[model samples]
Target chain A: MTSRRAFLQRSGLIGLGFVAADALATSERLLAAVPGLDPGDPEVPNEEVARILKDLFGDRPIRKGHLTLDMPVVAEDGRIVPVIIESDLPMTPEHYVKAVHLIVDHNPDPHLAAYHLTPAIGSVAIQTRIKMKRTTWVRAIVDTSGGDVWAAYAHVNVSLNGCG
Target chain B: MAIGEARIRIPDRITRGDLITVNAIVMHPMDTGFFRTAEGKPIPAFFIRDVVVTYGGEQVARFEWTSGVSKDPVVSFTLKADKEAPLAITWTDTKGGVYRQTADIAFTAA
Candidate 1:
């Protein structure tokens, strides 16, 4: 019969193995979607952001107009920073916003979220809260069903680290 | 608040063709796994990864999120009052936890 201490040690090792495997799986999934993603590299956030944008928009030019990104100029608490995005662009059957991508330039994971929308949404107004690791630029990229992309960004000074 | 508990808010009065806003907040820790406890043990990452909004049996919006979302995440969006139907919001977490909330959009004659 196996000793109790030996069994506990073995189980702990197995648990650590599972945790490592789960982390690997997550990075693999992200790498598959964004080939340039290097989750471990500290200097890759900007590159990763650009790579993700390229992956989504290809060689299409991203216009700087039509999107309004609103967030606090200085976030006293980095853990919960409110963000609001509004666009004057029309939302009709023929012309509508297809997706809105949120990105934080310096976060460990720069790609915060991607919101896919339909014309039935009626407008391009969205509000959410995000965590910022440090002072960084928060970007809002809007893609229209017609293949055009508009981008805007807001600079936020974070007083505390939120990713811990 | 419980991990799966959610609160959704919508206008009580609605008219056909008028745009309405829906706001939802869910209780979640959104742990990023990068933090360590007092004993120096790493915290495991657990967060909601996907959220879907459907109206009248049709999908209107879908959100794919990472660990950067805040704890007790809140999301708001606008939708057209095209018909009187059930609006549903579904949240799916990384550990296979799925939480859902639905609210009926009853239209009042303009």
Candidate 2:
């Protein structure tokens, strides 16, 4: 005897709850990996990165925008495999790009590189070479207008890992 | 600057659908930690670990690497076709300094 309106409301509540749980899970996962990363450059904790990012913004995670990752799951040549990131969001001076972080999973330590972009960079695009330890996920987290964090994941299959 | 000779090869032109392979090599000593100086001092980590290449002022390729690359670093990638554009290469030192250079890829009948 539940009304359709009541069912819709319940479903909406469930959706909201799921989203909250998902966000929590993502943050936890990020934090969990923070300790093991002895990157040698500097042991940059995930929290410090979060803090830096928060200080830049109003203490909010970047918004998820329309983003695409261009890379193959398996690379024929590990020394250099092609990779690219393309965001569908409009690139303009008024509401333009901020930065892009490259997360290469195959490497012993992730958080491979960061590209600080401006309107002059045009569309916040970046391409780079990353040494893969094994089969790994390459993620591109982009910060754009509205403080959104749009990310795209790419699984790189490497037959010849450049790290070797 | 241990090696002076390097090679760069880019296909004629790139368009939306066309995929082209780009190749580059930089001559340098990829000194891994396995070696030591005459006094047995572990040479500080000095390697080109990061590389960025842009086309037509838009970034087209990038690389993250370590000293494991080899004595000399050679990087190659593929990209879609575009009009006449310049491919810029910037090699980043371990401590984060950049050695910037550019290459022009011309759109010609291939």
The prediction achieving the highest lDDT against the true structure is 1
Candidate 1 chain B: worst-modelled 10 consecutive residues by lDDT:
B101-110
Model 2, stretches more than 4 Å misplaced? A1-59, A62-65, B1-44, B49-92, B95-98, B102-110
Which residue pairs of candidate 1 clash?
A: none
lDDT of 1 by residue, A59-144 (tens): 76666779999999999998999999999899999999999999898899988999999999999999999999998878798989
How would you class the docking of model 1?
A: medium
State each model's C-alpha RMSD to the native: 12.8, 12.8
Q: Highest DockQ among the candidates is held by which one?
A: 1
Q: Tens-digit lDDT track for model 2 on A3-105?
A: 9999999999999999999777766655444432222322222454544434444444443348877887778776566667677665556775566676665
The stretch of ten residues in a row with the least summed lDDT in candidate 2 chain B is B11-20
Q: How would you encode candidate 1's per-residue C-alpha lDDT over B1-110 as one tens digit per residue?
A: 89989988999999988899999999999999899889999989999999999998899999999999999999999999889999999999999999999999998766
RMSD of 2: 12.8
Q: Report the poorest 10 consecutive residues by lDDT, candidate 2 chain A.
A: A36-45
Q: Each prediction's TM-score against the native?
A: 0.83, 0.51
Error of 2 at A35 (Å): 17
State how far residue A127 of model 1 sits from its true place (Å).
Answer: 0.3
